[model samples]
Target: MADGIDQLPVVRTITCSHPSHAGYEKDFSEFWTGAPDSKLTNRGDTKKWNGGFRGRPALADALWPELRNYLIGRKPSIFNNAITALRAFWRFLDGYERYGMEPISQLSDISTSLSILWLNPIDEMWSAHSRQAHEIIGVLVRNARKREKMQSAWAWHPYPRAESTESKELPTEGQIRTAMHLLKQSAYGIYARWKRADAMAAEGKNLLTVSRSRQGERNQKGQLKRAFDFELTEADAHATYRAFIASSGNPLPSMADLFVALGLNGKDYPPWWPTYSQDHPQAGQVVR
Candidate 1:
């Protein structure tokens, strides 16, 4: 039974055959007729008396709270009745419709649901848990239809991924060689020279070889002074390079030449060259 209830068909009617207000009026008449105070009159029985008793307000106070509870809780029954009333009211205003009446609940959600359910051929009420539930369902239906139309317009075809133009325009082998040659002449090469000099200096030697004499010169006091000769071993060169690297804040060397300005090594120096070839294939090789 619970499964059946879960699978129950939706009722999407705008209204029933009769208006609830009309039903209330009919019942009210019957109640009035049964009243003990009910009295009849002749054509001129009293000057103030009319043919019928004065009509009471259509709805009672108790009915209002029941209606309020239904709308607040979105109890399915209130949702349906409110929608029904709205549809009837609209139809009544249209004048062309024979059956139309105002609805009980003035809630916005209830009115929205009525607009949708009123579209159904069966013209039945749709129950919802909350006033907004009606609006939510309408939105879902509208979005679903929009998605369907979008799918059909392209014949349900899938779009292919776009290829990157940059990849297709890759540089040729000649361009690569030209880039390498230009890089060799860049500041990176200068840094490499400084790194080699620094490494050598760490080992208590200089990477640059001074061909000047080791002979001493006489001092002011007639004492002989040792020559200012400079040369660096491989380990010293490596240490010198480390120091140069530290002065750089570990940043990649800029394109401009900072090496020559620091006097690491130069074209004037040969054989005692600043760099260790092969180990440093690039202009500058960073040691880990």
Candidate 2:
């Protein structure tokens, strides 16, 4: 029986009369041939694949567990594609019954079971991918029922949203200061490196001859030089500060002079009021 099964020709095509069903047929054929332990043999071959199960019953029994095992440490995109292929297989089975073949059990049962497996406590990190897969499967099942002219038992159930694991607390003032200091230091270092490079270039020497750490400091310096070809003006800083104040919903105390210069009454005025003055100091004056 095993040898006979191994000699069975691989499924190369899935036929359906519906024009819209062509893509699903192709996907199913590809999956059937490619899936591990699929008992169907390749053309002119008699060996069974090592990884996939034999037929629909074997697939139905082992698909989810095998899929979960395949997805271990895989990327989210790969997981999405795997689920898509599985859903296509289910769609093929549902459509095949239109030609007088026996109907398989509703795939929703398998989807629900897989969803529970995805939510297993030991592998909590895959919750997002699992939710996405569940939603995709739900959509596929709904579409398959509509195409087959059958009533759908697959009820819509919301997948639980994954909570963010990142820290939500705002940075402390000290932390902010430290970040600013680091930024200044980085800027200074980049500037010094560029100056050295410029001097080397002026002396008819290759800029690459300058000392650069393995962290791609040379590439970084080149990028920085190209980026800051033009100097940032005082107006830029003023605009940035104003934008920050607006976004932060904080009153701009230091910018009161800027408001007076712009002719807006700075005293007891709402933060958004525009001020203009003929002698108004450049927007950079207050910022400086």
Candidate 3:
């Protein structure tokens, strides 16, 4: 009887029959096997890899920690691969009715694991890999819970990195005056060029509309001339404005702000001005 039992074929049981189960099985199998031939040595190591989760409890208790350990000090590519595999496994488990709802303890466990990874020490000069790891963990954990729950958990924190120091020396009166003068000149130049461009755009639109409406012999010959005029004027206006902006070397306000600075009334502005003013109530208002 023992010999007969040993000879019997092994059977596998699948509790969930959802179509996604097949995809889950495939992802889990690939994660278990790992990519040994890949250039990354850590990725090729199968011993450290956790054969995918058997259930929700296993996923939270075993697989999460395994992934956190595997990703430590690893290259971004390998870290991303592990994260992707874990996401697929989690998604599959979440879809399956039997293990869909995650318990609070499991969520807490995963959050703690992420916090530990995030707080891991690194060199004084922060590395790109460390930043990437922090971002990935934050995104994954945030997505795992609802917005309200995430706010309540309060486990997540800003990335662990050095803050830049503020300059201690203040500008002298002469330096401040010189800077202000340069900024004013640049702003005035930009405003003038913007107004020219705005006028040209309005004229071009009118010319184009007129050219399009002329369908009779009385206006046929002048239609092409009008269209060419519109295009040339529009092109020149845009080019001049762009060149002025590029050369200004200073931050400038929006066209509407420039219009107001030039003392133009909002009521006499283009048709789009009303809509824009409604959307951005502060646009035409004077800024102090």
lDDT of 1 at 259: 38
lDDT of 2 by residue, 1-288 (tens): 111123444543323334444433222333333344344555766574323322353344334334444445555555547646464444334333333434445443333223332333221212123555555554554444444454212233346666777887988999987876775465445444333322332333111122312222223323221222234333333343343333333323355544444343445332222233234343223323
Write down the lDDT of every candidate, Cα atoms only. Answer: 0.33, 0.39, 0.36
* Over 4 Å off, model 2: 1-7, 12-27, 30-34, 37-54, 57-118, 121-131, 165-288
Q: Identify the superior model by lDDT, candidate 1 or candidate 3.
A: 3
Clashes of 1: 23
Using all chains and alpha carbons, the TM-scores for the candidates as numbered come to 0.19, 0.27, 0.23
RMSD of each: 35.3, 25.5, 21.1
Q: How far is candidate 3 from the true structure (C-alpha RMSD, Å)?
A: 21.1
Candidate 2 is scored at a TM of 0.27
lDDT of each residue in 79-181, candidate 3, tens digit only: 4465554544333332222322233235534532233322431221111234554546555554454422432212344465676769888889999878767
TM-score of 1: 0.19
Best by TM-score: 2
Minimal lDDT window, size 10, model 3: 1-10
